[model samples]
Each structure stands twice: as C-alpha cells, then as structure tokens.
Target: MQAVNISGFRPITTSVPRSAPYPSSARWRLPMKSSSDYGSCDFSCRQPLRISSSFSAAAAYTSADGETTLIQSSVGISDLLIVGPGVLGRIIADLWKKDYPGSQVAGQTLTTDHHDDLRQLGIHPISSGSNVEKFPNVIFCAPPSRSADYIADIRSAAACWSGEGSFLFTSSSAIYDCGENRPCDEDSPAIPLGRSRRTDVLLNAEGAVLEAGGCVLRLAGLYKFDRGAHTYWLSKGSDENRPDHLVNLIHYEDAASLSVAILKKNLRSRIFMGCDNHPLSRQEIMDYVNKSRKFDKTFDKFTGTDGPLGKKLDNSKTREEIGWEPKYKSFPFFLGVNTD
Candidate 1:
C-alpha cells in the first residue's frame, strides 16, 4: 500500500494496486495495526465512522480527492490505568470508556475514600503492583499535595510501565504563575514557584514524563457540574465584594474530552495547555451568573485592587494541532447565558 497522511483529510497522491478492483473514490477500510506496522496513524480526523471499537487498531480510507482518514481510535491498547484518579481523572476515564467501549479502565488511589464510588462507576481499583503490562496506557493525575514525593511516585509508576503506549500526566497552570498580567501560551516563560516548592515538584514530575516521551497537560481552573470555586462562592453570595481578576477555566466535560482526544490522537512528549477560549474576570463571571441564574448575590460598591491582574491563556496551538475544539467556549456557554 502507498504511504498516506491520516492526521487530516488532506488530498494525497497514491496509486492503488492492480489486483485491487476498486474505483478511486471508493472507501477503503484498514484494520488497526501498530504504528510500526502502518506508516503512521492520523490523529486529527473527526466524524469518522465507527468501524470496529476494539482496542486493536483500525482505519478507514474514504476516496475523495485522495483524502486519507486514519484515526488511532483508542491507541489500540486493551486497558488503561489512571494513577490518583481524582475528579478530572475519573472524567477522562469515563469519557475514554464511552468513546471506546472495548478498552478496560481502572484507577489507583492511595486511600480508600473513593474506592466504592469508583467501583460504582465501573472503574476497578488498582494498586502499584497491578500488572502495568496489562494496562499499557497510564495516566498520572496525582496533584502536588504530596509535592515532596511526587517525583518518586511518578517514577515508580513509570518504572512499572511496559512502554507499550503513551503515558499522560495532568499538571496545573500554576506553573506559569509568573505574576504577569498578560496572555501566555505553551512557549511562554514561567516564574519559578520559589519557596513554595510545590511548583518545583510538579515541574520535576513533568520533566520525568517528558524524558520518558510521555505527554504533560497543564490544565486551568476546572468548573461546571457543581465543582467550581466560583460557583461555591456564588452560592455563598460572596461575589459582590471581590475584585475583577482575570480567570481562565475549562469545563469539567471539556477537560475530559480534551484528554481523550489527546490519547486518541496518539499525542506524546508535548505540553498542552487545557483551557477554554474565553478568559473572564471575577466580576464579569459573577455578574453573568447572578443575572442568568437569578442568584441575587450581593457585590461591594467599592472595587478594590488587591493583587495583580491575572493572565490569559491562548489555546490556538491546541485547537490547530489536535483538530479539537471545546464544546463550551466560555463560562457564558457553560452557564447558558444569552449571548444576544
């Protein structure tokens, strides 16, 4: 077979074999195989037909101006294991299972606090000694709470990995808290988390993943579905007295979707900043929520400038590279606020 670009539906110049009796415009279906077996998997195509949801790889070629549509479709891994699967991790695992039914999903938690809850969600609890070979796709979602031991924890988990597929680590955008009141992207410089030591630990863990050819996603403040800090404050009627500091956020669902998108696209060894397109201020979000939800939250008559204005995030690289866009563009969309 001829080499084809499967990432996007771009036109390609290739000839079919003489033995194959098919027109140029015919749709050709290919079975899933390893990246070594096939030329390369296209991780950018959307709206693809569900050929075989099996963990084994599969691809489909639609004949239209020689466009090749090759979606990795679950990375061909039969199982996935999430380390320290908190809220975001659970969301990713659930979305992954929903998108690819054939894959087995499990989670590893240090404490038993969420074991029963995870089991109810159909995610089996796994330990460090669990066969990493069986679950080649591993995601590290542990936060910096244990900053002192984060590096060792990730390294230990990574050491157990069989190196069959991609490993993704969830990092926080606080790493970029350079105190700059401007917009930043993945290439921007970040201030050292001096004295705090938490940022250093997180950075160390990210470095380890990068060294291992894994992926690191720096996420913004997560909200929606009764889990936003802003929402908590709003419910308490506390938004009226706060300053309008800039804030970036990604809806829980969008974050989950993006994680699964990265995996299906076979992305690795890169840092992706996960945030929605809009960056609203505290007062703006509060006002919108109050007006839309009729919360009747009280605000202070005086606006106090206590801290530096927050930074905005640019997500153009993620959108262009992954061919994925957040279903919720901004907080307004999440809150169902009327744009008109």
Candidate 2:
C-alpha cells in the first residue's frame, strides 16, 4: 500500500495487477445515527469517523492506443462530483472530506480561475468541456445565472452521473409562491412556470432533476458572518427597504451539512427544504443587528413597505425525513443573541 498526498490528508492507495478482475460491488456506508437519535445529535459536535473500508472497485481508462485498463479504487459515497463548487458547494466539500477523509471530491467550474484554490482545499478542479470520469455521487450547485440554459446544464450534469449513487440539485426556496408570509414546506405549491421568470427557471430545473430520479434541495437565503442579508442591509443604508417583508435564512455551514446528509442518505426523486426555521421581517433583522452591535455600521430605518412579503419556510418535515437538523438554529442564534 502507498499513501497519496491529498492536500494535508494522506489517503492510502494500492496498485492492482492488470490480470486481476475488477470487483463487482464496492459500496461503503458512513456511520450514521438512527432516525430517532439524529434529531438529538448535533452534526458539529461529532468527530469525523474514520472509514475502515478499502477500494475494491475498478475504474476503466482508455489509452491512446484504444487499450482499456482497469484501475482499482475505493468505494463509498466518498466519490463526489460537485458541479459549480462555489461558496455553499465548497463548504459541503470541506465538511464531506472531514467526515470521510478517503473521499475523492471534484468540483466543476466554468474556468480554471479557481483551480489552484480548489486544489488547496483538496478538491480536484474540472473545467467545463473537459473530459472527466463519471462519479457515483453528484451534486449540482450551479445557479441559473451561471448558464444561459439552466435546465440543460442540470440535465447534462445528470448524464455524467454513474447512476449507482445519489444526484442532488440545489434549488431555491423562492420557487415557492408564498409571497404573503404564509408558511411553506416541501409540499407547498411552487410558482407556475409562466408566472415569475426567476422562480420559473428554478422550478423547471427542479422538474428536470426530479424527472431524472434525482433529489431537489430548496435552500433559503444563505448567509454567513460577513455576507448575509444583514451585511447587505447595513452596507446599503437605504430607506427604500421593506421593513414588514419577511425572510427565511440558513447559515452556509448548516446548508452544507444538510446537503451531505441528504447525499449520504441517497434518496432519489425527493424534495427537501433547508432553512434556519426562523422567519423575521426586514425590520426585525436590522433591529437585532443594530442592538447586538456586531457591526460598526448602523442600518438606516426602512421607510418604504410596499413590496412582496417573503414566505415563512418550515423545514420540520425536511428535518424529520432526512434525520438532520441545522446546527445554526436561527439567524439570532448565529448572531450570538441567545433567544433561550
């Protein structure tokens, strides 16, 4: 056995003789809690469990001479291909590696601009139009803005999958037509295709993935310390903000964890929602930020109130079905404002 240098981690590798036949099944499972225990367990509190499984499956590579070669590799949900590995995708990759150190993670980007940075994070970078191997597990995190045709891009990514594992598409909660601050869930009706262009794109993309037996994760407004709705509000300092409009949010890390959990579960043709389970008005968010004094800049008081009030998203069903919970329970929780 030889060690392969993957960023800071060294995953063991072994060379197999060409004469040996490839193994048929190479499935590996991560240590997961029972459905009842998952709700009580905190994903952040657990240590990364080491996998004792070895790669027995072979990958086929064709040479210039048209000679086919078999290469033995490790088996698990560990072999992941993330299409459009941006902020949320990167977090998901890092967290996935933390849990399964032997995992082989690759990210597909439009250009080679972030290739080096991705390598530094132990993720192999694959540029668009480049030849790549089929991955057992695939997640499409690319937004519609990145492509002229979002549905085609998603279908193409699905075609690249091995179909032996899970395929997940990250959709948006905005697709839900709950504009009156009504509670929305996985069963909530989405905006019909012709209604809103933005939501229509997402809804069409979700339909494509679902038609292909893939999972769809409709995520809420994603935020982190310096880049969430709060930061944007403080920077704008505008009076045109809608104070009464509600917003649901999820921390980037929590979204990432929930993604990995769903992928590990390997559910197909299912729709899941991700949110911090806290819906606050724009005014409420700003007020909390100002009172906490987390930032130096103070947001201007919102004066205008004539915009669509955002929906209140409830992912309780999502939590129970996936057996996962958001580590950052709410925006206030992430801000260190103890609600309890």
Candidate 3:
C-alpha cells in the first residue's frame, strides 16, 4: 500500500430501535446486523431490510460530484480515543456522539482545552498520559500533508492499542501522483510527489496501525462548512486549480459515520479509500459556484499553490467490502449546489 495523507461531537439520542425505509445514514446504533440472521446480505455484507437496529456497513458512499457520506449502523466504543483534537478532530468527535451515544470518544491534542472538549463529549482526553492501560478503540483523524513529522504523531498514538478491538488511521489520496489529469483508484500505483513519502511515512503509518491489526482508510479531499476545496474556491472567486482534479470529497458526517460502521462490524486489517465516486473539474465546479452562489467563482487557468493532489479516487472498496454508500454525494445540502 502506498501512503497518502487525509484529513465530531456526540449528543445523546433515542435508545429505542425501530424499523423503517433505509435512507443512507439513517439508522444510528440499532443492534448488531447478523448476516445469517438477516437471511440476506448486500454485496458488502450490509444487513438487508429489517436486518437489525444495530450496525450499518452502514455504507461509505462517494458521489460523482465529490461528496463523501457514510451511513453506519449501531456500534459504540466502550472507550473511544480521537487523537489530534484539532478542527478535523473536533468535527469527528461531535459527529461520533450523534451517531453512537454509547461509545466513548477521547480526543488527543497537545492543546490544554482539548482535554476539556473531550470531557464535554464524554471522550477521554489524551494530553500526555497513555491509555494503554485502558486500550480504547482509537481513531487518528489527522491529515497526512500537515506537519513534516505528522506521521510520528500518529505512531505515538498507536503505541496505546493493545492489539484488540479497532484502531484506524485516517490517510489521504495524495499518495497517488496526480500528474495533470489522471484519476487514481485504490488499486492505482503509489506515484509519489511533493512532501508525501508514499513509500515511507504515509505507508509506514498505515502499516504500523495494521501491524497492530488495525484498519487504514485513505481519504480524499474533504469540504464542509465552507472549508477545504469549496471554501478555497469561494475565497478565491476564481477557477484556478484543475476543477476536475478528480474531486473526491466526503461530507463531514460521512467520515464519522464510517468510523461507527467499522466499530460495529468489528473489522480489521484492510485498506479502504474514502471518497465519493464522481470526480469533477475545477472549472466545472467554479462555474457551478458562480451560477449558484451568485459570487464570482471565476479564475484564471492557474493561480495559488499547485502541488501534487491525486485524481479520481475509487471508493468501491468501501462499498464492496463494507457496504458503505455515502449520503449527500456532493456538497449540495451545504453548498446550495443541487443535482437532481
């Protein structure tokens, strides 16, 4: 596997289980979906209708327009740990609570307030001491492209998993070299570029976690609440980067939902790419932005920074293997960009 980098709150909800028409990220934590019990299963092992109130392979879906929506079933972390309590980490922590009130998510950050935030979310804070004694199912929601030594940060966290339960490290799609105009699938080559050590840290981090019997999920570029790709363009008001740079994005909700799914399924030791299937061009997106937002989303052919971002990320692994199909296939609900 090559290395790429990628980059919640919890709220208490109903404890009652119900059966209804399955919308993609609908059921929270119902009960464990038993394949034999369900009597029928989807390609990815998802429980058929009336499967159970429990878990969703829930589906990790990527849209053609670049949206990542994860519909997961019920599962809780007896003790959940979220390392890197930054913006991304916070987002995950919030969503985790909404999906699985039963699970305990603890976020780790050098920041002092992170401890308080974790406490608020009912998550244990890992500021200094280790949870090795506790062995919480951990989720390292960190970006692979950030700090030069970011990989080391994750390694330090993995030191805690006692080779039990689930431990996931969030990675990126940048591991595949996107030269000009090419979309890379999970099976694509690890064509490295920029600061990514496709052969080193990115892969190393994934290997370390997996060696400990944990799972690795390679994520594509993400956008939500006016952040990341869409935000960048909104702020720029111009079409610069390859609008069609194979936009594979997951909504904030999908990421958290997928985590819930993994815990429910008790999965381990596999590589899954996180993204909506549809890849769009920057020009096409910018045009949409201008047409919809009534803002100047136009730009010259080239502007801002140009680094090696991967293209056309395949999220079929998530679907075929875990029965993941994201909701909000594109940033529509939030973007005012509709696709009917």
Winner by lDDT: 2
Candidate 1, overall lDDT?
0.61
Name the candidate, 1 or 3, with the larger TM-score value: 1
For each candidate, the alpha-carbon lDDT, in order, equals 0.61, 0.70, 0.53
Worst 10 residues of 1 by lDDT: 20-29
TM match of model 2 to true structure? 0.78
Pick by TM-score: which candidate is best? 2
Overlapping backbone residue pairs in candidate 1 total: 6
Which residue runs of candidate 3 sit more than 4 Å off their true CA positions? 1-77, 130-132, 144-151, 177-180, 192-199, 239-244, 294-310, 332-334, 338-340
* Clashes by residue pair, model 2: 55-74
Per-residue lDDT of candidate 2, residues 27-46 (tens digit): 11222222222121111112
Which stretches in model 2 have alpha-carbon errors above 4 Å? 1-77
How much does each candidate deviate from the true structure in C-alpha RMSD?
Answer: 15.3, 14.7, 15.5
Backbone clash total for model 2 is 1
Candidates ranked, most accurate by TM-score first:
2, 1, 3
lDDT of candidate 1 at residue 2, scale 0 to 100: 25
